[model samples]
Target: MNLANTLAAFPLAVRKFNPRLLVHSPVMFTVFIGSLVCTLVSIQQLVQGSPVAVFSALVTVWLWLTVLFGNLSEAIAEGRGKAQADSLRAARTSVMARRRLAGPGGPGTFTEELVPGTELAVGDIVVCEAGDLIPSDGDVIEGLASVDESAITGESAPVIRESGGDRSSVTGGTMVLSDKIAVRITAASGKTFLDRMIALVEGSTRQRTPNEIALNVLLASLTIVFVVCVMALAPMANFANALPTPVVLVALLVCLIPTTIGALVPAIGIAGMDRLIQRNVLATSGRAVETAGDITTLLLDKTGTITYGNRRAVEFGPADGVAPFRLIAAARLSSLADETPEGRSIVDLALEQGDGQPAQAPEELSADVEVIEFSAVTRMSGLNLPPGYPANPGTRVLEVRKGAAAAVERYALERGGFVPQELEEKVLEISATGGTPLLVATFDGTRAQVLGVIHLADVVKPGMKERVAQLRAMGIRTVMITGDNKITAGAIAGEAGVDDFVAEATPEDKLAVIKREQEAGRLVAMTGDGTNDAPALAAADVGVAMNSGTSAAKEAANMVDLDSDPTKLIDVVGIGKQLLITRGSLTTFSVANDVAKYFAIVPALFAATFPGLGLLNIMGLHSPESAILSAVIFNAIIIVLLVPLALRGVKYRAVSAAKALSRNLLIYGLGGVIAPFIGIKLLDLVVALIPTIA
Candidate 1:
C-alpha cells in the first residue's frame, strides 16, 4: 500500500462509525457511548469553571481517538483488496464479437458479422477465429481450437477447446490459437467468469466467519458486565465522602473493555481472503476458509488430483502368433471415431507403426458401421457393425472391443474364444508398473480372439508427494480413489505416498467413501474436476474445484483454484490455521493489558482523597493528571501499532496445537500485561514536564 492509498482510508474510517456498524462490535459500541457522555461532561465542566477543566478536555479528545484508531485498522485491510479489484477489472475490457448468423436452415450456418461484446445475449452464437479473443463464457458448438487461458488461469500453455467434450467450455477474455470455433454464449454482459472472479476476490459480499460471531457474543457479554461495574463505582466513592467525576468513570470503562481484539477482528478476516486472491484462489465465503483448518481427512481422485489426467497410449504389443500389422489395424479401426485424448493417442500410436502394405483409412468404412461410446458400467467401448457390409451383417460384423482386461476376457469367451496365458501375463506386467492395460479384441462370425494390449501411461504430478507430506504433518490423512484395476491403483497410491487406496471405484463408490469418512466423525476435504465427482464434492466439508473442470464440478465446490493446481490446498489450510491463531492471540493480549492499566490509574484517582491508597501506585506515576493522560494514550496507540501484525498474520510453526498455544501465550499474554506499564510510565515522565498540567 502506498502513502496515498493509506491516506485515502481516513474518509472510509470516519464513515464506518454509523450506528449500524458500531452495534456489531459491542465493545467498541459501548466505548462510543462513553465517548459521547465524556463530551457532554467536558462542555458542562467548562461552563461551571471547574478546577480540572483542561484534564476534562484532554480525556474527551483521547476517547474519540480510541474509536477512530479501531476503524482505521479495518479500512487499511479493505484497501488492499480494492486496489487488486481495480487491476482485475482493467483486464475485462469489452471487445467486438463476431455474431454467427443462421442460414435458411437452422443454427448451424456460419456467415457472421462483428458487433460489440456487450451487445451479445445469452444463447447467442458467436464465431471466435484464431488470434481472436473469446467474448464471453460459452461452449463451442461448431469447430475446434486451442485457447490461451492466461487471462484467467495465468498459464502460458494453450489448452484445446473442441465442440463435444468435457473441455469444450471456454471462459471470456482468453485468446484462441489454432482454428475457428462457433460458441454459444452462456452468460450475458456484466456476468462473465471474469466478473464473478473479480467480485469474489474483492470481498464485497463477504459473510462473517462462525468463530467471529461466537467471539462477538462473548465480548458483548463481557462489555455488559464492565458497564455495570463502572456504574456502581460512584456509590462506592460517595461512601468514602468523595464522589468520582463522570469523565473518570468513562475512562475506566474504555480501558477495561476488550477493545484491542474487538477492533482488529474484522481486519484479520478480510486480510485472510486477500491473501487467497494473491495466491490465485477464490473462496466463496470466509467460513469455508476457516473450515480448511479443521479438516481431518482428505479424499482425492487419482486422475488430475494426484497424477496428470492425460492418460496416453505409450506402447502397443501383439498377442502371440498374431501378426503385428493385423493387430495395429484393429486398434486404429476401433479408435477412429473415439474423441477422448486416450483413444486418439491409441490411433496415433498404431498409425506410426504400419508395415510395407498400404494401410486402410478408417474413414473408408461403409455406412453400415456404428460407433459405440465408452462407459463406466460396461467397462468397454468400441464398434458394433452389422454384417454383409464388411464382414457379416447377419450374425457378426467384425466387432472390435477395447476395455479393462476382465471385460474383454468375458466378451471373447461369450463368443467361443479363450483368453491366452501370454495375454494375461502381459496385462499383469503392464499394470504392475502403474500403466493402464486396455485389452483389444476382435469378434467375427468364424473367429473370436484377443488381438493385443495398449499400454496407457500416466505420471504422478511432480512435487505432489512433498505436498502430501505437509498435509500429513498437519495431522490430515489422504485417500486415493480411482476406476483403475487394483494393481494399478496400488502402484499409484504407493508412488503418491497416500495413506490408503480404493480401486475400481464408480461414481457411487466415490460418494460412499466420503460418507464413510463423515460417519467416522472426520471432516473431509475433496479435490476433483470431473462431473462424476460433483456429488462427492458437495458431500465433503471443503471441496476445491479446478478452474479447468466442468461447470457442474465448479458449481458444487466452495473454493476454486484459478491455476488449477491441486497442491494449493496446502496454502489454504495454513492460511486458515493462521487466522484462528491470530484471533486467539489478540484476544488473550487485550484482556491481559487491563491488569496493568488499573494499577496505574486507581491509586492516582484516590491518593489525594485518601493518602493510604498511594500504596497501590507501585509504578509511582507523577500525578493524577499525568497518570490519567498516560493510560489513555497507551490504550489508543496500541491499536495503531498492531494493524500491521493483523494484516500479515503471526508467524506460524508446523507443530502440535498445544505447543503453538503455549508459545503464543508467553508472547502475547505475559508480555501484554508488562509492556503497558513501561509505556504509560514513559509517557507520564513527559506529562509531568508540562507545568500547566502538573
Candidate 2:
C-alpha cells in the first residue's frame, strides 16, 4: 500500500476495535476481553500502590497492542482495494447517448435527442457511431463496429462487436472506433459492468468462503480449550502458594491462543482479490477465489482457449476437370463481400496466388450484386451476380457460393449438378488433418458445377503445449472441448498437449463434463464467452468468463477476465493457491510458536514455589517477571512484523501437494518453534535491566 492509503487505513483500524465488530472473530475477541480485564486490574493496582503495578501495566499495554495490530493488517488490505475502486469509478463518467426511437423505421431511426447515459434504462435502444461512447452494457442489435474497450479491459487493441453472434456484447464507457451499431441496452443505470467491478474491488460485498469459515471454527475451538486450561491454572497456582497475578494469566492466554493466524486470515483473503485485480480479473465472490486453489480438472474450449479461434484459408484444392485459375477466380469472387476472418483469409490467399489482375473490391462491384451472409441454417455465404456481369456475361444470373462442403454440395445437386467424386475425397482428406473444407460452387440459373475446396486450417496458439504442461505439473488435468469431429479434435488436442479431448461437444455436453468430474470429487474450472456456455459456466466449480462474452455468460460466471484472455485461468489458479498456502504457513508458525511461549511462561510461573520447575527454564531468564514480560512483548511484536507477509501472500510453487506440505512443515513449522525461543530470551536480557522488575 502507498503512504496515502496506509494513513487512511490507520483510523479505520482503530475504529474496527469496536466490541460489537470484534465479537465476530472469537479468538481475537477473547484477546480483546483479556486486554479489557488487564486494563481494569492495572488501574486498581496502580491506585493502591501494589508492588507489581508497573509489570501489570506493561502487560496490559502489550495485550491491547496485539489486538490493534491484527486490525491494522485487515485495514491495510482493504485500503489497497479502496484505492483500486476509486480508479475504476473514474472510468464511469457521464456521456450522451443517441437514443433510438422504437419503431419500424429500422437502422437510422434515432429520436434526435441526446440523452445522458445515466438516463437510459434496460431495453432502451441507443445508436453508437464512430468516436461515440457506448451508452451502456448491451448487445449489438444492428450493424457491426470496431470498439476501443481499453477503459474496461486495459487492452489498447480494438475488438469487433457485431450483431447475431457471441461477439455482440459491448460494455458501457467503451468507445466505438469504426462503423455504427444500434445497441439494445441490457442493464439499467448504476447496474452496468463497470459498477459491478467497482463494487467487487471495494470488497464491501465480500463473504467468507467455506474453507475460511471452517478454519475460523477450528481456531475458535482451540481458543476455548486454551481458555479452560488457563482458568484451571488459577486454582492450581493458589494451591502451590504462588498465585499468579490476573494480568499474568491474561498475557499467557493471549500468547497461547492461535492469535497469529486469527489476525491475518482476513488480510490473506483480501490480498487474494487484490492480486486478481492486478491481473485484470474481477471475482464476484471470495468463494470462487478459494475454489480456484482446489481445481483439479480444467475444461477449456478448443477454439479460443487451446487454438487460435480464427480459421484461415491455407490452400486450394480444385475439382478434377476445372483449371486452377478458374477455381481461384471463383473463390476470390465469392469471398470479396464476406467479412469474417475465414472469408478475409480466402481473399488474401487468392490475391497472394497471383492468378490474374487484382480482383475488384466489394464496393467496386455493380450495385446489382447481392451479398448473401452466412447463417447457421444455411451454413454458407456468397454473392448472387446479376446477368451480363463482368465475370458472368451469360444471359442468366450467376449464384457463386462457398460454405460447408455438405451445404454447397446440396445446393449444386438441387440444380441437377453432381458433386465431383475426386472433390469429395479432397474434403475428407482436409477434415482428417483438422482443416475445415469450404466447397466453392457456381450456378448460372440452368447449369451448376462444383468449382473447388478452400482448405481452412486451424492454427494452434503458440505456447499452448507449455501452458498445458504447466497445468499438468500442478496436478491439474487439461481437457479440450470442441464441436469438431473426433479426428479433428484429436489432432488439435495432441498439438496443444492437453491430457484429454471431447469431440462434437454441445453446450449440454460441456455441463455434463463438469458434473462428471465433480462426482469423482474433483474441483473443476472452465472458461467461456457465449450464451450457450452459461449453463456450464455456472455448473463449474470455478467459472471464468471473458469480458467480451454475452451478458448471460458474464452474469453466470463467478470470475470475469477483462482482457478477454482465455489462458488467464493459469495465473488465477496460482494466485489462489498462494493465498491458501500463505494462510497455512502462517497458521503453522502460529501454533508452533505457542510451544516456546508455554515453556517460557510455565516454568517461571511455578519455579520459586516448586524448585524442580527451574529445570524447565531452558532459556535461564533473569527472573520470573522478566521472563513473562519478554514472552508477552515478543508475542505482540510478531503480529506487526507479519503484516507484510499476510498482505503480499506466500509465493506458490507448482509442486505436488505432498511435496509442498513437506517443504512448508520443514520451514515454517521448525522455524516457528525455534525463532520465539531466541526472540524471547533476547528480550529477557533487556527486561532484566529494569530496576523494578529485576
Candidate 3:
C-alpha cells in the first residue's frame, strides 16, 4: 500500500513484458501475439491512406495497454514483498560473534574469540550474554536464559530458552535478555532459516501450487477454445458477404479469453505469502498454506496445544491412616530430581503447606539417593534413598515412588503396601474432574506406606471455546489428542468445545490417527513442538511447529509459528481460506467480463454485414469503432481497479464452504457478469463524444 512501492512497480511492470517471461503464460502470450499482429496491421493501414486507418491505430493502442495492465498487477504484488524483504535484510546485518576457543588440553576451554557472524560455520561454538543478539540459528549446548524473539515474532514479552529438551533452540537475530548460553551453530553461512524465510515471503523461491497449475491448465484450454471460436467467425462473416477487419477479430479473441484472472494470479499468490509473514508464520512452501484451507480434520495435542500446558500441582490429599504432614514430606521427597513443571510445582506446593519459615526457594532434601527418572512406559519416578534415614534402615534402601494410580498401585503391592479404598476413590474423583492425580507412596525395610495423591491442574486457554466454534462454522472437525486418561481428556475436550478426542495416545497413535484421516480422504493438520512429534508432524497434511520447540520438530514442520501460540492456527486457517477464495472469485470475475465484451464488440463488428445484428447493441453505442475501443479500455482499466481486491483477498467469513461459496458467487459471480456491461456502456458514451474515435 506504500506509494513508493506502487511507483517502483512501474519499471518492474514494464520488464514483465519481456518475451521470455510472457511466453510462460500461454493465455497472456496468445494475447501478446494478437497485439503484435494488430500493431503491424495498424502501421501498414496508416501508410496506405485508408479512411478507417485511425480506428486501426486506436485499436492497436488499447491491445498493448491490456497486456501492460496485467503485468502491472503482478509487479505491484511482487513490489510489496520487495519492500518487506528490504526490512528483513536490514536485520541480517553482519556483526561479530564471540566464538569459543578450545583449550590446548581438550574441548574443555570456552575462551572467547571474535569472528564475524557471517563467517561462523556450522558446528562452531559461540557464546551470547544478556543484551546480545544470537548470531545464528542453533541449539543451546549449555546454560539457560530468557530470549526476546521480537525480531521475528514482533512480541515484546520475553520467553525462556534453556538447555535440554524442546525449548532449547534459538533463532538468529533474536536477543538474549538474561544469563548466557553457549550455542553450536547448526546452519551454514548463507543457508540460515531466516534466509529461506526471506526468500519464501518474497516469493522468490515459490513454485506454482498444484491447484494453481491445474487452474492454469484449464485456463489455457479455455483460451484455445476461444481462439478457434473467434477464428471461425471470420469465415462465417466472409460467407455472409461482410468480413470484419483483422483487428476486430483479434480484439474479440483477446476479450473472450480469461485474461483478468490470468493477470492477477501471481499477485494473489505473492500477497498470500506476505500475509503469512505478517501473521508471524513462516511457510516453507505455498502448497502448505493452500493445503491448510482444505483440511477437514485438525489433530491437536492436549498439552500446550489445548491446555496452558504447564501442569501445576494444587493440593495433596492423604490416604486413610496416613498423617497429612507425612504425606506432604513424602510428596516433596518424590519430586526432588523431577524437573518437569508438574514435579517442580509439587515441591513448591509442599513447601507452602509445611509448618516452617516460608522460603522463596525449596531446599533439596539432604540424603544419599539415586534418582529414578519417569518414562512414558513406566509412568513413574522417584528417589531411592539408602536409609540411614526414616532413621536407620534394617537392610533395604527405602523407595519413595510417585506416578499414575495404576503404576503406583502395582509398585505398592510388590513392596507389601496397599492403596486404601479412600485413596483410590480420591484418585478417581480427581481424574473425573480432569486433574491428573499422582499417587505418592513410600516403602521402608519392613513396611510399605501408601501416603496420598498430588493433584495436578491445568487451565484451558481463554477464548478457545469461541475459536473452536469458528472451526465448526468452517466445517473443520477439531480433534484433541492426548496422553492423559480418558476421563480427563473427555472433560477437557468438552470444556474446550473440540468436536472429537483421542485419549491416552502414544507417539505412534498420533501418526496412526493422521494416517486414518488421510486414508479416509480427509486432510489433517496438527500443531506440535516436541522431537517425539516429528513423525506425526511430517505425516499430517499441514504441520505447524512452535518456534519455542526443538530443532527436530521445527525442521519436520512445513510451517513454523514464531509466536509459539498454538491457538494462532485459527488465524492461519483464515488466511489459507482467503487465498483460495480470492483466486476463485477472481477467476469467476475474469470469465464473467467476457459476456459484456461479447455483446459490445461482436454485434458492432457484424452489424453492417447483417443489419438486424445492430439490435444487439442495447447501449446504442455510436459506431463499431466506439464499441470496440470502449470495451478494450474497460478491460485494461479493470485489472488496475481489481489490484486492491486481489491483494487484500475476499473478506473471509467463518461460514460453511457452501454458504461461503454461495455468498461469493452472488457477489463476485453475479456482480462480475453485470458490472462490466454497465461499465462498457458508460465508456462507449464517452467514446461517442470523441471526434477522433469516430
CA lDDT scores, all candidates in order: 0.83, 0.88, 0.84
Off by over 4 Å in 2: 1-5, 94-119, 129-132, 177-179, 357-361, 391-397, 418-422
lDDT of 3 by residue, 1-694 (tens): 5577778898988898898988767777888899999999888988998776887788788889888888888888877777557766766767789999877777675477899999999999899999888888899989999998866676889998888878988888888999999998989877877787778867778877888889889989998898889888998877776537888888878878888888888888877877888778888888988888888899888888788999999999998776787788778777877888998888789888982323222234454667788997888998788856542122353888899999999888888888999989999899888889999888886667788999999888888898899899888999999988899999899999999999989889999999999999999999988889899999998999999988889999999998888877778888888999999999888887888888888788789978899888877888888898888888888888999998898888888778877887898888888988899989988888878676
Q: What is the C-alpha RMSD of each candidate to the true structure, in Å?
A: 4.8, 2.7, 3.6
Q: How close is candidate 2 to the true structure, as a TM-score?
A: 0.93
| Models ranked on TM-score | 2, 3, 1
List model 1 lDDT by residue over 1-694, tens digit each: 4568668888988998896988888888887888899899989989998877778888889889888988888888888777667766766878899997767666654577889999999999999889898899888887889889876766789988787655667888889998999899988899887888787666667889999899999999998998899788777766665437888888888888888888888888888887887788888888988888788888878887788989999888888998887777777777866777898888777767863323334576566787777776778888866664443212444688888888899888989887788889999999998999988888886667888888999899988888788778878899998888899999999999999999989879888988999999998888877677789888988988877766667778898887877767778888887888888888888889888889877776677889998888988899988888788888999998888888888766677778888998899999889888898899999988877569
Worst 10 residues of 1 by lDDT: 388-397
TM-scores of the models, in the order given: 0.84, 0.93, 0.90
Name the runs in model 1 displaced over 4 angstroms. 1-5, 43-51, 94-127, 130-135, 175-178, 188-192, 238-243, 312-403, 410-418, 440-454, 610-615
Off by over 4 Å in 3: 1-5, 44-54, 97-103, 106-115, 235-243, 321-340, 343-356, 360-402, 442-446, 654-657
For candidate 2, the per-residue lDDT at 165 reads 80
Clash pairs (backbone) in predicted model 3: none
By TM-score, who's the top model here? Answer: 2
Which pairs of residues collide in candidate 2? none
